[model samples]
Target: MSGGLAHRWDLSAAAAIALQKSLAGQVERADRLGPGGRRAIRHVAGVDVAFEEGGAITRAAVVVLRRADLVTVESAVARRPTRFPYVPGLLSFCEVPAILAALTALSQRPDLLLCDGQGLAHPRRFGLACHLGLLADLPAIGVAKSRLIGAHAEPGPAKGDWAPLMAPGKTGGRMMRIGAVLRSRAGVKPLYISIGHRVSLRTALAFTLRGTTRYRLPEAIRRADKLSKGGAPG
Candidate 1:
């Protein structure tokens, strides 16, 4: 909650999975951003990670942008030795430490976080965005380029159109809505938008759409992606 890495990172794959299940209960599905809602947000940040030296080094990038104009406000990059193996659902264990480090380097924390990974739309309903949101205690959204779980009808081939992403619930065989499949740009692949923490699915969808520009990815995330891959200095 204090922008610190509170949990242990040297966890086994089994332990990490157990931890995710345990922490998933703490994810708040409701909006916590107060009455102002979207207007309350001024700065938004995007987080992403990349591998280097053939996967030995893990690089993380954080780029903060003005929500109104999408101008870069602050950016940071951090690198660490990759300790965890490439586990399918447990990627947070591999990426979060460096992300926290990169976040610490920021001069100011953004009002919202947009992560390039899954959130409630995960197999256990807890993914990188959820993990980072809980640790950072900030409103966050997952803007994944691909689906991690669930199924949905294709979104309309136009910007701002979306469809609900549904998956099996715990009871009654009724499909539970987890996220949204959003078309950020016309005729391009849809993005999976999900609540990370302290945010509603509707708010997440709205913000993701608001943040997107001419590309399939949001502007903040697109810049963060470039930074993570060593495209340019912050």
Candidate 2:
């Protein structure tokens, strides 16, 4: 649980190349199973992290949603003074610790974990969501607000229009992969859904779309966003 070992596959620098190369192979290797049987999705978890005092203290919150209905089931929060630098692609080093602290405090395990960040769409293909999902050994998806690394057109206003997101790299060649197109209450935003640990790109997109009430952010990420900053569920 220290690093991203959720798929039961521990990723070292040897396995995950730097940004100059493609990292999708490393991810595809770790992914063993696909989406399991469809249930009510009994429990869903959202994780978010915030920084205070110019990123000195990191506060993280985890909110669990009900499968029957998107209601709050369990919640936990933890804070710690961060020591990692604000590296662009190495964000997990700073945020993951705080998130891990919060996850450790959770009372129950969630069936699906949604994160307000990217998944395999990273230079090393190991973004925050992928790292946490792998560490927790749970089903998870990465839903980011802004573009991290990919090329795509604007999705339709109706909903469910998607395109492949290509991770920028040269040596590893093409990094194009599937993502989601969503119409949230706020507006239309393209969500990059990727397999974190136990979930697939398609399944991740479906659950993310289902969790949305009226926002570009998914239910799990939405709740996590507010909770991380100590805000009430909107």
Candidate 3:
């Protein structure tokens, strides 16, 4: 085991079949709403990671914001030397450890974890948000700036207007969750969202909308992303 199996993660090629069986039930543990279902909160946190030398060096930053007034409470950063190669589906392998490290150092923990990546919308149903949420045991959602996988329709610019993300069979809801929303604009691009841990699709969408103001991505991700590039890791 790579000790990366903390979530009881299934990484073994031989155990692939068994792992899929086990994950089948766990993925939709949210009952009618599914695993990620939670109300949008005033106190929210953002996490972002940056890599240098072509992802060889990584920096992770986390920021806690008050939903009541949108003020920063706690912020942290973690830097480390990346060991994993830059594979498309395995981004969590490089970012998760540093994100977890930054989360641990937060003095004031936010109610939600807003990550700068994808969640259940991956081939393995294990993206950055899924990895961090499961590890933190908290409500987390992914807000990726780019498309790692799956296909979707164009949404409206008014925000809250989203089209169904096409996923085949069991993986259908992996990208869109159940009621998750995707917003699109002419100049600005749309973002992909999914329940990471204990959150619901409705709540995830609500939070995503609320956190966003005058920008495509939410503040949490925006700040962490900037700090992660050259800023010191906490």
Candidate 4:
């Protein structure tokens, strides 16, 4: 895939923060998934990263699956030295380099990306998902197992139930709905769903629910997580 946005990954913490704040403005919250709505999403890719050698090395994995059947179509993995320290609200700087390498290795580009991290839910309103989506110029959604920056009420205990995730807005000192807490499986803890780039919250939630099956995570992300952890692909 083409590198949609260009920036040097090696930077100081202050520079990184500044870069994130600048890029956050480029994030388009509107839906750009194209016609046919959900059906337009034919191939969905999941991105994840894992650490090795006491966090000295990063193993990033990208797994693309057919949206209709959730079968793996293409997969790639890349390993690189860990360049950045683990910092809250700055995970993209630590992980995105290796993830971009893995993505560049893919022969089949996906229609949508399901990132294993936050999106607009971050403190700077730019998370790993948003960073990757903007860099790849693809529609992406963040599917996180935990919250990063948002307040929300618990969703219902059943599948398909959801509650709004709110954050303080810049104007009027009001609370803004940044994302949603969605229960992908019945009786399971909800997953945090947020827009990454070029996708709407509703479309992101729908795609996330469609990608999930027996597990609490979406199938593509689950497989990518396993791959990143040194497990063989299913």
Candidate 5:
């Protein structure tokens, strides 16, 4: 990780919030995955963390899959003590240390990262995905099963339907479009899609739908989730 991205993880809730606010400005929402405006996503990695022993230990997993065939390319896990408390918006601080370890263990870094948490759809606009993307300096997207912040209408029951996620502007200003509510599978709850870093929301959604096959979650993320839960890597 770069020195600017790798900062103090041990912080109080107030300090963490301040850090988030400061770093949020560095998050780039533009598409940076291609050479010349073309799709260049080849490998996508999913990241997740699980707590064990009464939330005292964290098991972080990262699974990389080939975008064309969805074949597992690399997988890694890191276990460490839970350093930070479970604050609502500061989840990255609690989980990212181990996640970085797992990423470092990989022989090949992925082109994109898919996090099982919020990105721009956050109160301070710096969620776990955003933090990881910035730290890793890779194009990343957040595919959360639920919302962390923002409001949106329910999408259609069919797969691929989506609605815009809106939040009240800063300081009670106008409404702001943050992310999207996307139905990844037919007749299932929608997933929250948001820009992490170095990717546009549209490209993030495209990559997400392409990565998803028979399940609501993307294939890479499914594998990572399983690994985090002590299941064998895919």
Candidate 6:
């Protein structure tokens, strides 16, 4: 773990909330991805978690794909005894250890990560993607199936249309931008996109759209989800 974000995972609910608040400030909400100049994003990773043994075990799967063609280049899955109880806002505590293990098993690190959870859109402004990105020091984005916080108008019916998701700021009477509600596919429900670390919201949206084809979620995330649910890894 990075020095600033280093902390224990096993903690009381109050401690977890406090830890989130402390680490949330470390998440960089800026664009720092790709191979610097003229190099396109080549490898992108998707991470998801599933439960087994009636939720006693946490299964984390990571799928790295070729960015241009969305072909699986590498994949890994890790199983660990669930360490924390299901907490609404403290999801990273329950899932990130196994996720880190799975990521460590990969042959090479991906250029970007798409996490199946929230990011800066959470109550503490630090969700699973933010936590994982800080721990791994990788550019990451959150591609959530549903909203965890914030409110927004319905996105347009067409694919690629999006609307800003806003929430009340710490100070009263101020609305802060948290994430975006995106229509990944025309006929399907919109997705919630947010910056996890080292990437801007616009860049996150672009990469997410580039990774989506014929589905409401990105192909990397879809594959990772399947693997996390016990599907064979490629």
Give all candidate RMSDs, comma-separated: 2.1, 4.6, 4.9, 1.8, 1.8, 1.8
**Model 5 lDDT tens row, 1-234:** 432567887798999999999999999999887422246777889999999999999999999998889999889999999989888899999999999999999987788899999999999999998999999888889899998899899998877889999999877879999999999989778999999988889988888898889899999999999999999876
Q: Candidate 4 deviates by what RMSD?
A: 1.8
| Candidate 1 TM-score, C-alpha based | 0.94
Q: Please list the C-alpha lDDT of all candidates, in the order they appear.
A: 0.88, 0.68, 0.68, 0.91, 0.89, 0.91
Sort the predicted structures by lDDT, highest score first. Answer: 4, 6, 5, 1, 2, 3
Tell me the spans in candidate 1 whose CA falls farther than 4 Å from its real position.
1-5, 34-39
Give per-residue CA lDDT, model 4, range 1-234, as digits (tens). Answer: 655578898999999999999999999898887323344778899999999999999999999999889999889999999999899999999999999899899986788889999999998899999999999888889999999988999999988999999999856669999999999999789999999998999989999998899899999999999999998866
Please give each candidate's TM-score.
0.94, 0.80, 0.79, 0.96, 0.95, 0.95
Q: For model 6, state the Cα shift of residue 190 in Å.
A: 0.6
lDDT of 3 at 142: 73
Judged by lDDT against the true structure, how good is candidate 1? 0.88
Worst 10 residues of 6 by lDDT: 1-10
lDDT of 6 by residue, 1-234 (tens): 232445677899999998988888889998878754224678999999999999999999999999988999999999999999988898999999999999989888888899999999999899999999999888899999998999999999998999999999856759999999999989999999999998899999998998899888999999999999999898
List where candidate 5 sits over 4 angstroms from the true fold.
1-4, 34-39
* 1 or 6, greater by lDDT: 6
Candidate 4 positional error at 148, Å: 0.8
Task: Tell me model 3's lDDT, rounded to 2 decimals.
Answer: 0.68
Model 3, position 51: C-alpha lDDT score:
83
Task: Summing lDDT over every window of 10 consecutive residues in candidate 2, give the lowest-scoring window.
Answer: 1-10
Model 3 weakest lDDT span, ten residues long: 28-37
